[model samples]
Structures are given as structure tokens and as C-alpha cells.
Target chain A: MSKKRDDIIDTTSDLLERQGYFATGLNQIVEESGAPKGSLYYYFPGGKDEICEEAIRRSGASLEKSIDRAMSEADTAAEGIAALVEGISRAMEASNFGAGGPLTTVATETAGQNERLNNACEEIYESWRATFERYIRKDGIDSIRAERLSTLVLATMEGAIILSRTYKSTEPLQRAGAELRELLEFAR
Target chain B: MSKKRDDIIDTTSDLLERQGYFATGLNQIVEESGAPKGSLYYYFPGGKDEICEEAIRRSGASLEKSIDRAMSEADTAAEGIAALVEGISRAMEASNFGAGGPLTTVATETAGQNERLNNACEEIYESWRATFERYIRKDGIDSIRAERLSTLVLATMEGAIILSRTYKSTEPLQRAGAELRELLEFAR
Candidate 1:
């Protein structure tokens, strides 16, 4: 990605999290990214949908990497998971809770309404779930259990972020992370 | 709610699920409900936000009732929960998976943007969680664990519905239900 394209994706991710796919406009993206008006069309011939698709994909990947970093440096998968959860909490603060899971709002807003965005969101979620599943497996959980565990973990994180942001309290996320970590042997 | 009010609520729910709060306009609600333009103002002084709040609360109450019904009829809280999960799957299909969860989307969309709607959704979620927590406690799970379990169930349902609707497949919901059942048990 060009520096300009990267900035466009970065800024769009912010807008998508803060608002939603429908509410975030090209004008806003240009205003935030400092990308020229024509540049949006030049880079993304497919328009907002295309830009959102790329932004959402990067959001998932970046989240995956963050979680990966948190886990890899931990003493165990359990701590890694804790770090991952805390990482999200920090992100919630960084975005002033204005920014949430990118695909969540898009998934809810456009799932049945727009097939293209829906598919993009679906891909993003599946990829995130898969990333979590890999970590769950790496944690030594059984395969059957890992998949389910990963699903729950992802769902919990997604839900917690919303609740924590909505209530302006981290209680939900804190409780959720504690519960999940307790499931692992690493809980002290 | 009056007959016309229910019609508007139902229509708004469908629109909110498929299109979202921002994308679904009062014009569409008026057109879909066949309610007069003046009627919306009468029912909701706050317009769309009020309508969305009412719809979300109604949907939340409906879901809580399902949980109560399932628990009351079940031999144990476990089966009650299982039945509730199954009930959600059927309900999603009944709604054509057009829109997933009302509270989830409403929370994400308006939580930060709209304070009144945000508080209403917070209360809705808290009420549902309290109800679920009540039964989970009755089922013998401890207090803290029960709350966490309820949160997990809500998240999984929300996530599964989004995935199911996107893929037009109920498999995620079903799979999520089974996993949820496990979490409920595992929480103990």
C-alpha cells in the first residue's frame, strides 16, 4: 500500500469504528487522511464499499497481530489471552470508546442489506475467530474445545468492548477476561 | 403499544436489523408502517432515536421472556438455557435473519452518539443479564460466574446471528448454541 493508501485505510478504520460504514463518507476520509478527493477514486475505483472492505480486512489483521503480540510474550497462553483482552481495553480508551470493533457495526448494519459488505465482514470475523482458534490450540486445548472456546472468546471480547464502552465502565471486559483466564491453568 | 405502534415498532425493528439506525429513515418507517407522518411525532417526540429505543426495549423484553419461559418449563436451568438457545435459532429464522439483535446494534450505533438511547440500551442489557443471572444462580452457579456466563451467552448469540445472517446459514447459531451450553456448564 502507498503511504497515502495506508493513511486512507488507517483513517477509514477510525471512522468505521467511530461511526459505521454507511455514515463514513469519502469526504470525511479525505478530510481525515489528507488524501485528495480524486485520490479516493484513484485508489479505490469501487468506492466506499471497496475502501471499507480493505479497511475491515486490515482491522482484523491488525487486531490479530496485537493479540498475537500480547500472547507470544506472555508466560503462558492464559497470560497471553489476558494481555490480549487488556490490549482491547486500552484500545477502547484510546478511541474514547468511539471506535469499536470495525466489523461489528458493519456486520450488524449491512449484513443482510448489502451482500458485498456483509461478505467482507463475514470474512473478517471468520479470520479473527480463526486467529483466536489458533491461539487456543497453541494453548494446548483440545481441537474440538478450542474452536468453541475461540468462538466464545471472540464473542465475549466483541460484546465486552461494546458494554464497556456503552457503560463507560470496564467492568464487563474485566469480568469477561478474568472468567476466560480462569478457564486456563495459568490463573493464579 | 397500540396496533399502529406495534406495526411501526415491528417495521422499525426489521429496518434497523437489515439497514441500521442511520440508514433507515423516518420516511421508510412511515412508508413501511403506513403510519401517517404526524403519528410518529405523536408516539415519539424524539423521532427515530425514540423509535429505536422502544423497538430495542421491546425486543429485549421479548428475548428475556423467552428465557424465562424456557427456564420455567425446563426440568433444570441447563435445559432451560438449551431451550432458550434453540428458541433464538427458530426466532432468527422466523425473522428471516434480516436483522440480528436489536439491542446489540442499537447499543453500538447510538451508545456513544446518543446519550438517551445509550442509557436505554444499557438498561435493556442489564435487565436481560439480571434475569439470566437469576436463573443461573437458581441453577446453582455462583453469582460472579453467573453474570459472566450471561454475558458470554449474549455475545455468542449476537455474533452467531450476524454470521448466520451474513452467510444466510443458521449453522453458526446452532454451533454457537452448543458452545454456549458448554460455557454455561463450564462456568460452574
Candidate 2:
């Protein structure tokens, strides 16, 4: 991606993460991104919706890489999940509680309203579930149970991010991590 | 609340639920609400911020009542949680996937920007955790375990709602309920 286009996605993702899709305006995106209006139009002619779709896709890919890296660092599935949970807490704290990135806020705002964004979110979620399922499967869990546990873990982490952001504390995420670790340990 | 105030809260809550705080405008509030301009100011002199604050509080209280009612109807902690999860899927489906209602959207949108709204969300979340904790405790779980389980359950539900909305299906929620039921049964 061009520097200008990357800047646009970076800023728009931040805005959507902090505010939401419907609340983020094109003017704000241009102003904050410092991307020339002509360049933005050149890259994304479909306006905010087009820009948002790219943002979601790019963010999702970036997150998948991060999850892969995090999972690789741990020897066990439980440890991998624990690291992921704590990493989320630290990221939220670092961003000053602007966690969930653009994903959660945009997903909620455009879930049924916009087909393109909704599809992006759905694909992102499916990718995440599959990733977790792979980790759990490594622990010898049955494919069906691994898939189900993966879904539950993903849902819990997403929800914990929301709570952690809302309460401005890592306690919720930590507790949620412990709970998940117990569940995964049971499988072991 | 007076009829005029109630109208404002209801309308504002709906807007917050669907689009979130930054995207929901005062003009839209007044126009969609059909409440007299004078009445809006008379009821909430501080304008949109005040209205949002009230909306958060009122919505929180209403949800707390619903939680209490749902808990009352179930004999065991697992049953209560299952009923609550199914109820959420039903409500979201009925509303055509506007499931987060006031909590998920508003909390994410205003977690750090506005003190009043953030505090209201915190209180609402704390109340919800407490409600779940009470049920877990009633099942003879230790206080520490109950509290941890309560937080996990809350996070899972909030995350599941987002997935359910994004996928336009109740499967995420149903799967989440199954996961939580397994955890609760293990505790028993």
C-alpha cells in the first residue's frame, strides 16, 4: 500500500475503534489521516464505506499475524490463551482503553446495516475461531469440541475487551482468562 | 420519569443501541423523538450529554430488573444463564439484530470520552456482574469462584451478542450458552 493509503487506513481504524462506524466522518478521516482528498478518492472511490471495508480487512489480517505469533510463543494451548488474554489487556491499557480496535465498534454499528462491512467482520471472526480451534486441536481435543471451545473462547475474549475498556481495568480480562484456562485445562 | 422525559430516554437509548454515541446527533434525537424542543430542554437542560447520561442509567436499571426476573425464573445457575442467553437471542432476533440494546454500543463508544456515560456503563456492568455472582453463589460456589465465573459469563455474553449480530444468527449465542453450561456443570 502507498504511504498515503496506509495513513488513511491507520487513522480511520483508530477513529472507528474509538468512536464507531456511523459516528466517524469522512472529513475527520481526511483531516486526521493527513491523506490528501484527491489521494483518498484515488484509492477509495466508494467513500467511507469502501475505506471502512479495507480498514477491517487490513486490521483482521494484522491481528491474525499477531495471534499466530503469540500462539507460537507458548508451549501449551492454555498458556497461549493466557498470553493472548493478557496481551489484550495490555494493548487496551496502552491505547487508553481504546481496545477492540475498529473491529468491535464497526461490527456492532454496521452488522446488519451494511453488507460489505458485515461480511468482513464475519470473515474475520471465522478466521479467529479457526485459529483458536487449531490451537485447541493440538491439545488432542476432539474436532467438534475444539471448534465449540474455540468459539466460546473468542466470544469471551471479545466481551472481556468491552468490559475491560468500559471499566478501565484489566481485572475482567484477567478473571476471564483464568476461567478459560480452567476450561482448557479440563480438556487436557 | 415524565412522559416527555421517557420519550427522550427511549429514543436516545434506541439511537445509542443502533448507532452508538458519537454517531447519534442531537438533531436526530429531537426529530426522531418528536418531543417538543422546549420539553427536551426543560427535562434535560444540559442537552445531548444529559440525555445520554439519563438514557444509560435508565437502560441499566431496566436491564437489572430483567436480569433479576430471568434469574428468578430459573432453578439453577446453569438454567438461569441458559434462559438469559436464549432470551437475548430472541430479543435480538425480534428487533432484527439490534441486540446490544444500550450496553455494548454505548459502552464501547463512550468508555473513555465522556465521564458521565463511562461511569453509567461501569455501574451497569458492575450490577450485571453482581447479579450473576449472586446466582453462582446460591449454587454453593465459593465467593471467589462465583465472582470469577460471573465476570467470565458477562464477557462471554457480550462478545457472543456481537458475533450473533455480525453473523445475523443465534448460533454464536447458543454455542456460548452451551459452553457456559459445561463450565457450570463442572462446578456442580
Candidate 3:
């Protein structure tokens, strides 16, 4: 994609991560992205929905890549999940709890209201679960257990992000990580 | 509170539960609640923020009561949690995925942007955690472990609600309940 398009998506993802969907205006995206106002329509003719859909997809893919790398680096699924949650905690703190959960706010805000955006979020979440399931399966877990465990892991991580962000503390994420680590170890 | 005030809060909570903060305007609230337009400002002098704060508190208190009742009815912490989650799943389905996590969208959407609302959300979350911590401690768990487990339970429930809403399926919540049950059982 063009640099302008990438910049727009990056800015939109950041804004969505913080303020959510409806609060994020196209004017704000144009101003923050420093891309020409006309370029937004030029690239995303579907307007805010298209821009947001692209942003969610991009954020989801990036996080999936991070999970893949984290899983590959650790010796066990438990350790990999621990490291992943820890990294999220640090990033959230670094951003003053403004980052993390790029898709969470959007997903919740649009769940039943906006079908197109809702579908995008559902797809992203499924991909993340699939990534976790693939790694947990490598740890000698049965397919069924791995699928269930992956869903729990994703739900915990998503929910912990909300708490950590709300409390403006990393403790929720840390506690979640520790708990998930234990759960994974027990599963193995 | 007057019946009108209660009506406003109830309607605002429903709107906030589904569409989030910014998306649910005062006009929409008034229109949907069928309360006089002037009555909104009369009831909540601080406007939308005040309305949202009350809505969050009401939702939190109601859910806490549900937790209390669920706990009292169950024989184990795991069973109580399972029942609570199962109830949430059924409610979500009943709302056609338009309900559940009454505070979640607002909590995440206003985490850092709106201080007053964020603090309300934080207090509600703390209350929920305390309820869980107290019950878990009663189950012969140490204070520290109870606290950690309570936080995990809250986070997983919040995250699972988001997934269930987005996917328009209660499977995520059901799966989360099952995993949490196993984790609590192991703790015992």
C-alpha cells in the first residue's frame, strides 16, 4: 500500500485504540495523519467504516505476528503466553494505558450495531485464537483442549487489558499472566 | 429516586451497554427513555457524564447482587462462577447479543479520556473484584491467591463478554466459564 494509506491506517488504529470508533472523526484522522483531506476519500471511498475496517485488520495481523514470534521464542506455551502478556503490560504502561486492545473498544461498541465492522472484529479475534490454538497444540495438547484453552486465553487477555487500562495499572495484566501461565502448565 | 430518574438511568444503561458513551447522545436517551427533554438536565445537572456515571453504578450494583445471589446458591466458588457466567450467556442471547458487560464498553472507551467516568468504572471493577476475592477466600484460599484469582476471573469474564457479543455467540463465555471452573477446582 501507499505510504499515505499506511499512515492513515496507523493513525486510525491509534485513535481507535484510545477513543473508540464513533469518537474518532475523519477530520481528526486527516489532521493527525497529515495526509491530504482528499486522500482519505481517494484511498477509502467507503469512508470511516472502510478506514476502520482496514485499521482493525492491520492491528490484528500485527498482533498475530507478535504472538507468533513470542510463541517461537519461548520453550513452553505457558512461558510464551506469560511473555506476551508482560509485553502488553509494558506497552500499555508506556502509552499511559492509551494503547493495547486496538480492536476491543471497536468490537464492543459495534458488536450488534454495525455488521461490517463487527464482522471484521470477529474475524480478527478468530485469527488470534487460531494462532494461540496452533501453538498450544504443539505442546502436545489435544485439538479440543487446545481450542478451548486458546479461547480462554484470548478472553482473559482482552478482559485484563480493559481492567489494566481502566485502573491505569499493570497489576491486572500481570495477575492475568501469572494465572494463565499456571493454567497452561496444568494443561500440559 | 423518582420513577423518572430511575427510568432515565435504566435507559441510559441499556444504551451505554450496547452503543457506548459518545455514540449515545442525550437526545437519543431522552427520546428512547420517553422522559421530558428538560428532565434529563434536571435530573443530571452535569449532563451526559453524570448520566453515564449513574448508569455505570447502577449496572455494577445489580451485577454484584447477582454475583452475591449466585454465590450463596452454589456450593463451591467454581460452581458459583459457572452459574454466574452461564446466566450472563443466557442474558446475552436473550438480548440478541445487545446486552452483557454494561460497563465494559464505557469502561474501555473512557478509560483515560474521561476522568470522572473512568473513576466510576474503576470503583465498580474494584467492587466486583472484592466480591469475588471475599468468596474465594472463604473457600480456604489464602488472601493473596484469592485476590489474584478474583482479578483473573473478572478479566476473563469481561473479555469473554466482548467476544460473545462480537461473535453473536455465547460459546466464548461458555468456554471461559468451563476453563475458570477447572482453574478454581484445581485451586481447591
- The number of the candidate with the highest TM-score is 3
How close to the true structure is residue B157 of candidate 1, measured as C-alpha lDDT?
61
Give fnat of each prediction, in order. Answer: 0.47, 0.79, 0.88
| Interface RMSD per candidate (angstroms) | 1.8, 1.1, 0.6
Chain B TM, every candidate: 0.89, 0.96, 0.98
Candidate 1 lDDT for residue B125:
77
**Poorly placed runs, candidate 2 (over 4 Å):** none
Position A87, candidate 2: lDDT? 80
Writing each residue's lDDT as its tens digit, candidate 3 over B46-115 gives 9999998999999899999999999878888999999998888889889999998579989888988999
lDDT of 2: 0.87
Compute each candidate's TM-score over C-alphas: 0.92, 0.96, 0.99
* Docking category of candidate 1: medium
TM-score of chain A of 2: 0.97
Sorted by DockQ (best first), the order is 3, 2, 1
lDDT of 1 at A101: 69
Candidate that scores best on lDDT: 3
Q: What does candidate 3's lDDT look like per residue over A98-146, in tens digits?
A: 9976799999899988999999999999999999999999899999899
Candidate 1 colliding pairs = none
The candidates, ranked best first by lDDT, are: 3, 2, 1
TM-score of chain A of each: 0.90, 0.97, 0.98
